[model samples]
Target: MRRIAPDHDQLLAIVAEVFREHGYEGASLALIGEATGLGKGSLYHFFPGGKEEMARAVIAHIDGWFEDNVFAPLRDGADPSAGIEQMLAVTDSYFRSGRRVCLIGAFALDDSRNLFAGQISNYFGRWITHLADALVRGRHRPAEAMELAEETVAAIQGALTLARAADDAGVFSRMLRRLRMRLGLPAKT
Candidate 1:
């Protein structure tokens, strides 16, 4: 089959789905090929380091997604309510985008401790920092903000797992609302 120029973003997009569906250990070259419409050889051409490389690509891509979709708005001096809304909106987008599984959570659960470990660590670190900073800015004490950020992030990740298992969007939405209340986030008018 003739090869075409690979759209790395599109490839990473499908790769995200594969990673989501199969986890790190389960996703195979064949599955990636089928997902990206790239034959094994072409897939290698794009990701010569094999699964590790693909995962690295996915992590980098998701880091950018976090920046654009999650953290950037928080930096805009968005109030606590607005910040919570953006968080929920991004959560909804993540599920509706069909990349329901979180790469960070998946990496945390994987057996390859060193493989893709640093990137995953950095991803979570940045994510937590973003949330903590936003919370602190919104009148939460530094420690209280960090604690709330951690709990909120944990709740969201857990809700995603439940949402995926039940195939229920309402579960996640309801869970998020409850989390907002627990965090003392008032509903946005």
Candidate 2:
């Protein structure tokens, strides 16, 4: 049987999952090779800079996805409440209702964070900023908006950690319900 090579997007997604599961430091080239069905030579051919390059590409891909799906909606939607709702929905789907780990968050907790500090910080920073902006547009006071955005972000991250630790997706769903109530949005059906 012949093999079909994955395109760049598919390749990045596969690499991202490896990083998510094993972390940047733990995701060995051997592991990535096994996951991607690529040999050392082929992996290097695709990622000339090796594992570090592959990690960077994965992070970049994740960043691009959030920029398009989460951040853009939060920053550009004409209706602030709608934007917030969309952000929450997209976030839930992206995280698979807490079944998946946040690769960037995982990187932030590991020593590998030192290597990709800028990208990691920028990812979270932009999220909070855009979220605060949406809250402000929704008629919240500026300071309150910032504070709420920060709290909301922290809560979501904490909930994800807790959900994973407890091995219960319900933990995440409960946190999301609380968030929606705090934002004065209707609970999801």
Candidate 3:
């Protein structure tokens, strides 16, 4: 059967959702097809490497999301603390206020990691570096900023797991709140 070409963003959105719902090795082409509304051939037209390629696409998509929503705001100079609050708001919104798990964390364990460990490591490293830069701009010592940034990322990832396990989104919310307090960020509206 002939297949239709899919929009890049639309395809990635569907792929990300499927991966988020099911881990890499567990993500079936049938399930991905169901999500993308694309037949096998159509899916291949976008991701010639199939699931792994789809995962690469998601990593790229999330990197862009971070650049625009998280990293960009973190570096905004007018009011970095406000920038931080906005970043937190965007993050909380992206995870549906903790109702959903982090896509990066989802890939961190199991067979998914086997395929994308480097990409996942780069993703988190970029996050920590940018966050550390922001903290330094806030007048923290370089060493302390790096440490804080690492802890902040760790806390956020951990909160996602704890919230999911506890079936309470507030766990994630509190984690963000604590990070903000630690960084002396103005309360998010």
Q: Name the candidate that leads on lDDT.
A: 2
What digit string (tens of lDDT, one per residue) describes model 1 on residues 1-189?
Answer: 775655889899898889878888899999989888888888888999998899888889988988887877776645755765686678668766323777778788778547878887887777778888888887889999888888888887788778778877677778777877876777645
Q: Which stretches of candidate 2 lie over 4 Å from their true place?
A: none
The lDDT values for all models are 0.79, 0.90, 0.85
Model 1, runs deviating above 4 Å: 1-6, 76-81, 97-99
After the best TM-score superposition of candidate 2, give how far the Cα of residue 29 lies from its true spot, in angstroms.
Answer: 0.6
Candidate 2 minimal-lDDT segment of 10 residues: 180-189
TM-score of each: 0.87, 0.96, 0.92
**What lDDT, from 0 to 1, does candidate 3 have?**
0.85
Q: Choose 1 or 2, whichever is better by TM-score.
A: 2
Global fold similarity of model 2 (TM-score): 0.96
Candidate 3, residues 99-171: lDDT per residue as tens digits? Answer: 9878888888666787888888988898788888888888899999999999988998899999999999999
Distance (Å) between predicted and true CA of 31, model 3? 1.0
Candidate 3: clashing pairs of residues = none
